[model samples]
Target: MAFLWDCYDAWQRALAAEFFGREHAGQAVVFHIDDDVAQTIREKHQLPESLAQAVKPHIDLGQRSHAFGTILARAQALESEAQPPRSLPLLAVSVLAASRMSRDAEIQAINYFTPLKRLLYGEGADDNDRKRDALDQSFGQVVELWQQLDRWLRSNKGAFGVSTITPDKFSNRARIGYPLSQALARLADRQKLTQFFSDAEITPGKTYSSAYLLRMLDAWTNHGRKRFSRRFEAALAEREPAFASLIVREAHGWDGKVLDSGGSGHLLRLRLAFNHKRARLFWVAPIATGISGGTLTSGGTEIGFESDLSPYYEGIERLPLTPASIAMPLRVHGRAAAGDPLVAKYSPQEIILFREDPHLGCWVSQDSVEAHEEHLLLVSPEQQAEVRQVLQVATSGFVAVPPPLFAAVLPNGWRLYRNVCFEDPAALSRVSRRHTETAARLRPNPIGRPKLVGGLPVLKELGSHHYLQGGAPDLLLPAAGDGSRRVSVSLGGRTPRTDFRATGYPIPLPQDMLGPGRHEISADDAVLSLTIHERVVDDGLPLGTGTFGSMAEEIDNPAITPLVVLARRNATETAFVNCDGTVWDAITPNVPQWLHRRRVLENAPLYYEIRLEPHDRGWLIERTARHVMAIPGSPTWPKEDAILSAEARTDWAKLILDVTAPPKHVLWPVYVKIARKILNDHSR
Candidate 1:
């Protein structure tokens, strides 16, 4: 994460240069002023030239008398609009001066320091090479292991090393498999690790080292190795603290089981925790395109877009495409008894897969259900027949696209009537609060509003710390006395708090200023300050531009816009941004409607979006675009059209993107800069 403190420091310097006519002198200076005394001096009818000269050292001496008077007026305006009883501006000024001095000193220190990049990345040539090779190989192995795990986990359901049968009825009820058999199976499952170790030339008695074993374990388990590794290490802590630390550091992922006391203790613990049976299985089906990007597959699979289109996704009524279950096994159809109207809704088509959750029955398969009408209706059994008939009638070479698939899973009857199950309690509560807050924010006078979707109202505790949108500051500020003269704000808007005090760096002021006081005009008066200073800076570079001016200037350069990108590698969100306002978003937004309806084919946008504040600079567009492109035929572009014509494509693409791309925000400093120019000086 880039720090915001750096940007604040830069802005402060820019303010000094533009308003005080201070050139970039070889050395930075610290000054102080007394705000109360300064105010009194400004209010005086007249001051003797000697008195004025005495005060001049603490003031922007270069400022014209008229300009000086304007400063005092602006100060008063700030005082009136401030949030509370204003402090003396002198103190603020003195603080700023000292802060700048400290920053300059730090910069001087940096000048004397040696660059550490080479030291960090370089060691003895031979050792460095070995380390690099080892790291690269380790990463490759990790990836291969992840692929293996992903494949193994795709199975609908099955026990790895256990049988369901038991001699005792109570034991059978516990679902516990014979421990010895399970143990043997687990050992067999270690073949992958064994192969890796062998390939790496590691052996238990001769060539093996603990690091090698740990590395092998990490590769085999992915990040799931943490828990068991910790347990094992904890058991060995007294004998080997160094080994324990090493294991903890190497550990990652969430899989693994340690057989303590040569296996007996492990069995006992498992039995105790799970009533003699412990089972875990994970199943995920990426849409047809896999988990590469945010796109809906013909089947029920969904991948995320690098940048999620959730705002639009959540607002849309249904998916843009329709799919149905064309073929499925276990098509056990039953008709409703004639007496009950509700039960007569449809000829129930029952299907079952490995039941992962007790309450979750088979999800509705979009490939099986056909759509003919604008709206999909769950109607009486008679209605089902009519709908099917209508669908058949319309099947005669119809050109219209099918409605997006929507699905739901009905819990098994027994689980539904007997007990409720939730996947993640924390997640459930979080999602509930966010949904409710969003719903409330959408309406006028939202007090006592009902939820937009069916779910429990989010309890206050759940959402108290949750900021659904727009909570964190878009830009960070470093201490002023960090030797940084100007804070480059990559973000677009002005910071929420323009005046901030950073550790080791005080608020900035002139070399002669001093004492507690309010600094920088409030927003209402900021415009006036800008009007007087009217300084301009290059949008693409750090260079200053023409002096104060009221004429508007058109910035047609590509550098002014902010660009955003997104990508998902291994089920994680990665985002990026560019100065030019071209934004890319790739997100595998879950289609909740499909999940809620228990449908196999998800009928909703794979991404969603919600507009928050104006713009944030840290947004990355490159990553998003790249991630989206990684999806097979994403945007479903033809392979032939996927080609980029020339190296000059940047110029062409920028033109096209400016007209066609989605708009997003820029980081704070940039926003603040642009805002200051437009609102304050009326120049673009």
Candidate 2:
């Protein structure tokens, strides 16, 4: 036990280099070995004959008066170079001594110092033969066992939560993986040790060189294994003594069952008090990616990002968004029901939900928010704006837009419904407050004046482009403080609009059905340019021998715009096609539309098509084509991208992806790095 502390003290200093601070001096591994200990190791210690002879030459036995500075110099050698310098001979000394130790120290060195010895053979091993020779002469059979564990971890990167993403071309030089996993992989390589060490005190907070980090990990692990019950109880006393004492008192009850049964995931997944320290470090990438290491700023903390098309984050709408059965848009020939008629009129609601993303934030999938259109619409349209505003706060589950705002929106007379099921009683208390506040924010209410959307009042306003999966939602909006008013619905600018004259306010407000894309409804002069987009699905795709965006006027060159795609019975969406194909998700895009044709037999691009749909994130590929290339001996066809000579033969210059993070967000360096890496590595 006493010698264990000495081992911890010795290596902790040697490995304490600040992350990436190679130029700065680091603390060296100072040995406490006196001449008597050294003399005992050289003569009486039953070490390997080679190690027995080498110990005297490497270890300073003459200096019984003081700890050896030369050994410390060897431990701290990495201050000048990369890769852990040859494992200090004293490390070998300590490890053997600990194993040969009689009482508390017998198994100690294997858990702590064994890693630095194994780290000799990682991704960068230059003089492998010599290192192996040294390892063989010292540790004997244990080296092979450690090497086997190392191999397993490297191959199973995903299982261990290592980042496979090679952002910024750093893979060729520096390896990227979770620091703890890497430390563990370089540690034993211990078999089950990875799970145990996850709770160990060592963290990568920019500290590199596994020597120091591994040593710290070893001490933490050894301490836990040796004296966890006592240490854990003591630690818990200062933090949550009540909970700890309750558990201690209750140890007579469920604790024995949990411990004896070896604990199911039910116990491990519990938050804070109930959870285990053995849980994985799942937040490393999500938080690490948000970090702007080069510079520091106040609001630089990027929680996450994703809503519409930015230069870097284009094609986000095309990402996987599986809405609930209710959230799924109404299919053309499909029969269905509604949650509420007012909500049903708005069923298949093409709501615009902007959640930059739920990836860096919480567990509630961003797609599920779209499923709540029915719930959202349950609030009157005026209140829909305010309720949504409250829902979209940074911590949607915990608190967003504040609980006061929630109370203000949904007020007393609002007949607030308790539909959401919360497991946490603490969060349960805030639900009604958020509901009430959000409802109160809805305009023309009892609390305050109206907040208008179009000519009517609203709590919040959405963007111009909206989305509708199927049925037309009824538009029954109240006029702002006027008895009766003139209302007309226009389909874009080109229209003799359908008009309903003298529509009564807050009553007899006639409803109208609007199509996909921008629909303008005006009363007096206030117009609402609202849009609803397609809820694109590859299955049950709309079929016709017609075109949406590929019409002559909608194509890139109006001169020779033939039908690029046509839908068919049992037709599957693919890049390969014959003649005209149906463009499934065609709507108002940056350009009218772009052809997404590819080689019929080969996975090659049509260059002109690439020029048009550069940022097309699978939205346009819902296209099904009939004619792909060579139109049966038509030699005059343009063979681009799929052909070797295509680049030289085409008039269109190569399209360069202009993917930069939104200019206003200066600190979004992580996302940009991720985007650039994804684009560069993959051809599509």
Model 1, residue 633: distance off in Å is: 30
Top candidate (lDDT): 2
Candidate 1: tens digits of C-alpha lDDT, residues 1-684: 224223322332332332223231221111122223234343452322222222223333233223123223333444322121112222123222212222112222121111111122333434544433333232222223222322322231211211111111212211111111111112222223332332223323332234334433433333212233222333233323233222322222112322221222111010000000212111122111111223322235332222133211110112222112211111111111221111000112221112122122222211111111111122222233333333233223322212221122221121110011222223322333434322111111101101111111111111211111111111112212111223322111333424332211222222122111111222111111101111222322111111232433575533332222222333243332222333344455443342233222223322333221224323322233322211111121112222232333343243222222333333333422432333333223
Query: Each model's TM-score, in the order given?
Result: 0.17, 0.19
Q: Name model 2 segments beyond 4 Å from true.
A: 1-70, 73-684
Q: Per-residue error at 361 for model 1, in Å?
A: 26
- Against the correct fold, how does model 1 do in TM-score? 0.17
The lDDT of each candidate is 0.24, 0.27
Predicted structure 2, TM vs. truth: 0.19
Error in Å for residue 440 of model 2: 22
What local lDDT score does residue 270 receive in model 2, on the 0 to 100 scale? 11
